[model samples]
Target: MISVSSISEFVYCPVKAFLNQTQKDNIQTREMIHGKLVREIRRGYEEITKQNMWSIKENIELEYIFSTIFEEVTPFIKKVSKKYSDKYEMDYSVLKDICNDLEDDLKLESQFLSLKVKKILNTTSKRGNEIAEMFFPQSLLEFPLKNEELNLRGKIDKIEVVNGVYYPVEVKTGMPPSKGVWLADALQIAAYVVLMDYELNKEVLVGFVDYIKICERRPVVVNSILHNKLFGVLDDMLTMFEKQEIPEFKLNKNKCEKCEYMDICEYYG
Candidate 1:
């Protein structure tokens, strides 16, 4: 069974997937630290948003909403700071400085949350609210897939129903809309769409890439072109997996510099 992440690894360089699956263990490099930090921040934001819904009440003011988000994120901010301290081997003083900087940044984040809430309320589409609501909803979080042989599964961040159309959202903490479409992310979202479609028996409208760092949301229309491409990638990966032929690394110099497997990569061209 191939995972969406495995498909992305194959796309990055089949050799990466080959080495990753075959190797007993791999060392963590600096690049992995950055990836971890980005993931932590993304989770922090999600928690903040989840807590906001509970704080809402009749005739609630915008300030109250902003405050609730801010307070909810305080513990998370401290937790992230402690994680950085432990992982980076930084002293307490350095950690304090970093936390202070993050606190200052939270002000801007509060404003961003306010804008998001206003935008959701003003828009005729209920997609944003539906997506937000899904985070804390127990029924939605329950695993929706049961077939094990299908070789694909993913938990969508949220699903939005807009004008009778369903769209899935995936959040990221990295720079908003980085260069080139990320094949891994595409496959991940595709897997979610496929699962949802299987359960609902309807075509999902689209998927969204929400980059919290840059405060931008990009739509990824999952048309037949994308669907075919994803399937082709998946089929190729499954065939390779069955054959047990480890692929050769096609190293790109720029990517290798930031890859976690750089130390062990034989083809660091």
Candidate 2:
């Protein structure tokens, strides 16, 4: 299925996009492994946050709320640590120590959340709580789109209402506000909005690229000109996919050097 990630590859390079679409197996590297770890960690945090929100709605005490959630997540942490240890060839003792360290860090984060809850209660007035509750009410919004010809099917992260305006949000585990952010990320969100509008039959005015690592939210406002450009690229990609032709690599020396498929790429010379 074509994911928002496949859209990102198209922006990075059409040759890479073609390879990703057609290649049976793609190489993995240490960087990709580390990136996957970070993504998993961030996903865990998001899940905990969502559960915490639910607990708060249930009127559970903040201290117990955090403690309970942490307890439930410990097994998951241990499972991930064990998997990481098995995947990497490292000293067994060292791996055990690292796992212990990570466990402590998770505990510290739990304590921090407990403190945050107390602070929120102390600082927020009754009136403020009411306003905040209305603004931040729990909602699950998803945009599912499928294009059989393109072999694409995936759910966009969120379609939320903020201040009565619908916004599409795409989450990422990356640095904040790079120049490539707009050029690459905007297209994916634009595609999501387009698909969503088609499905819902309503126009969405704004979208966001949410960088979790840096806590940055980049706004993306899609207009006709930008949408047209994105559509053109998608058309080219679909054409290449249909023909089963590998596009010629436009050597991006810097990116190619870091790419996992560098060794196999015909243009490496």
Q: In model 1, where do residues sit more than 4 Å from their true spots?
A: 20-30, 33-37, 50-65, 83-106, 115-149, 160-166, 176-180, 199-202
**lDDT tens digits, residues 1-269, model 1?**
56555666777788776665556255555555555655566556666776665555433457766776677576777788787878787567855764565566666877766666655556534443453564434323223442366676555666766556777777665554455346677766777788777877758757877666565667777778778888888788777888997655455887677667778777765
Over all chains combined, what TM-score does candidate 2 have? Answer: 0.69
Cα error of candidate 1 at position 53, Å: 5.8
Q: For model 2, what is the error of residue 204's alpha carbon versus the real structure, in angstroms, after optimal superposition?
A: 1.5
- Per-model clash counts, in order, read 0, 0
**Structure candidate 2, residue pairs in collision:** none
CA error at residue 244 for candidate 1, angstroms = 2.8
Q: Candidate 1: what lDDT?
A: 0.64
Which 10-residue window of candidate 1 scores lowest in summed lDDT? 138-147
Model 1 deviation from native, Cα RMSD in Å: 5.0
